[model samples]
Target: EAAVTQSPRNKVAVTGGKVTLSCNQTNNHNNMYWYRQDTGHGLRLIHYSYGAGSTEKGDIPDGYKASRPSQENFSLILELATPSQTSVYFCASGGLDRGTGGAQDTQYFGPGTRLLVL
Candidate 1:
């Protein structure tokens, strides 16, 4: 099974400070993603990578950057953190299987990383 885990389950930062969050997956899946969950909105994708050394911006990639250095590691960087960026972040991993539709592939999620920008 695909398993994704994120570091720093919680974080606090001052406005305009820099923050970096990390993620690692054990399933060795080809696809990895970073997302944020906020009130009244479903999970929104920030970035994703198809494989090592390839990062693709998602719908809400603004204010955030991402890096995938290896098959198992992906990092999310907030260069200038703000209170509006405070939210619950999650990492997920999975690969497309013919049996499952591209959008229907079930992504395995990490526990979550909660950020608070003061």
Candidate 2:
């Protein structure tokens, strides 16, 4: 089973502070992703890694950076936290098999990490 978990399910940060969010997966999946979900908007990808030692910036990589030092762990770093960055972040893992035709690679998501900045 592919299982992903995130730390600090809730957080409160001051402006310009640093915040680090961690994620761990037991499924050993090749792809891991970090995303933020906000009301009236779809989940937006922040960062992703194909495997250990490889991290790539996603669509909304600004104000955030990512690290994947090992196969089981990935972290998201906010160097200068801002109230605009407040949102619920989710960690996810994608499996290789899509059941048929590889048309759908389902991404299993973690509960989420809600962050508030003030």
Q: Please give the CA lDDT of all the candidate structures.
A: 0.91, 0.90
Reference-based TM-score of each model: 0.91, 0.92
lDDT of 1 by residue, 1-118 (tens): 5578899999999999999999999877888999999989999999999999999999999999999999999999999999999999999987764555554356889999999999
For 1-117, candidate 2 gives per-residue lDDT tens digits of: 468999999999999999999999987778889999999988999999989999999999999999999998999999999999999999998767544334235687888999999
Model 1 stretches astray by more than 4 angstroms: 96-104
Output the TM-score of candidate 1: 0.91
Judging by TM-score against the true structure, name the best candidate: 2
Off by over 4 Å in 2: 98-104
